[model samples]
Target: MSGESAPRATVGSESLERAFGGTAACNACGARVAEYRVVALFLHETAAIRAYCARCYPAAADGDYHAGGDGLRLDYAAFAARFGAPGPPPPPTTPVDRMLAALVADPALRLLAPGSEAVARRRRRVPYPVRVGFALDGATSEARMSVAPDGRMTDLAGDPAACDRVRALLAGI
Candidate 1:
């Protein structure tokens, strides 16, 4: 690991559990993690932070150093503006947040807001599908995708091309 130390206001295990319950998902691999390290990334005129499980931290750090993992490349200023200094770095958003943000940004996809019956129904399925809300000209009016436990988009109810696009977006995250 690099010589860098943890950021200020870094929360301990008790705070983490209070903020995110017993399990928090790894920001990179989407695995449910009970233990993790939080790092604030400063790069290319941007700053943002994330919590990474042991397995994915190395790769995420490597990617940050190498300027890989493009898309909404977390400008530090923007992050600071959105989440001002104070308490623990805003807990990394859940995998669902990442997924919804990606889907909403794509013009070809019309993201569904949570709490709808459609979204709730899909969430009930075995293995659970990430209810995408909707996609324009998609295979189904109600868009939902099944994601592997690892966070990969395994299948989607939409045009193959749109699905591919969504998958690519998710992969970048």
Candidate 2:
């Protein structure tokens, strides 16, 4: 989850834009904003996008990166202590693998940082059922996917919006 474009998105209350914008809730502040200063979308975590307003912009993650004039400093040792190894090992090869990878690679799905390593292990049976079953297991969430006989309907165990996003991702593949 590192690229852009979520198919359906919006900016702020100013206007109703299209193509991967964001929601109304401010990540820093619970109130709905008049205009979204920033939107953050994470894969496999929340279904909706995160909206940040101008009032809370300085308190968001971008602010942490911007380094405000508070004289706060995180040296190398502190950084190392704060963050250990990045994540679990990458998922092994499987029939349903790389779908998420494709989503991550797509420049159109500017998803936030990926939190865990997930594998798409195929649930197999004889004759290759049209209703394919697979699971994507990550460090935090485990998502299950199944296709209908016609290959139209899909069932995802996690967030509905996330399920829709995954369905869209799989559709593109």
Candidate 3:
């Protein structure tokens, strides 16, 4: 989405002032953002601050607003092609993959490059498929890995630590 904040949307002056200091996630993509625009609040109590990047706040049709490198703006297809798209359902996973996934998920894991898109995209593709299992909220989650030509993740079993982390970083949607 566009890096610029939204233009005037007719929010109250007080509301805008409050938003200046607070932070909120983008309603369109869930990326953490500063409260720049207040839409509506629940039960007429609080301001339901719904701020989005310039691109997402305006042209986005659904929630999946994709921004480009400059964070300028983009349509869905272009976003998907440049940045890896979310994967579809896959088959079962293996024990090794599961462990790796957990390590990947760990906040302490230092495997992936820090704030490196080239590394993130390049490393996503595995020469061979890997699988992993995980537990969340007392439920079992599995993750599978698939490689692609652009070195992006083609498919993954959910909750796989590496898959989840990288996906979250890359997409942020």
Candidate 2, 101-162: lDDT as tens digits: 44443333322222111211122332222211122342222244553323333445664555
lDDT of each: 0.43, 0.33, 0.34
Give the clashing residue pairs of candidate 3, or none: 1-67, 97-131, 97-132, 98-132, 98-133, 143-157, 144-157
Please tell me which predicted candidate would have the highest lDDT against the true structure: 1
Ranking by TM-score: 1, 2, 3
Winner on TM-score between 1 and 2 is: 1
Q: Estimate the TM-score of every prediction.
A: 0.35, 0.23, 0.23
Candidate 1's TM-score: 0.35
- Comparing 1 with 3 on lDDT, the higher-scoring candidate is 1
Pairs with backbone N, CA or C atoms under 3 Å apart (clashes), candidate 2: 3-110, 4-108, 4-109, 4-110, 5-108, 9-20, 9-21, 10-21, 10-22
Q: After superposition, how far is residue 23 of candidate 2 from its true place, in Å?
A: 9.0
Write the candidate numbers in order of decreasing lDDT: 1, 3, 2
Superposed model 1: Cα runs more than 4 Å off: 1-89, 113-126, 133-143, 148-150
What are the per-residue Cα lDDT tens digits for candidate 3 across 70-167? Answer: 12222323323433222222223332223233333333332211112222233454443444333444554445565342434556665655456445
Predicted structure 2: lDDT: 0.33
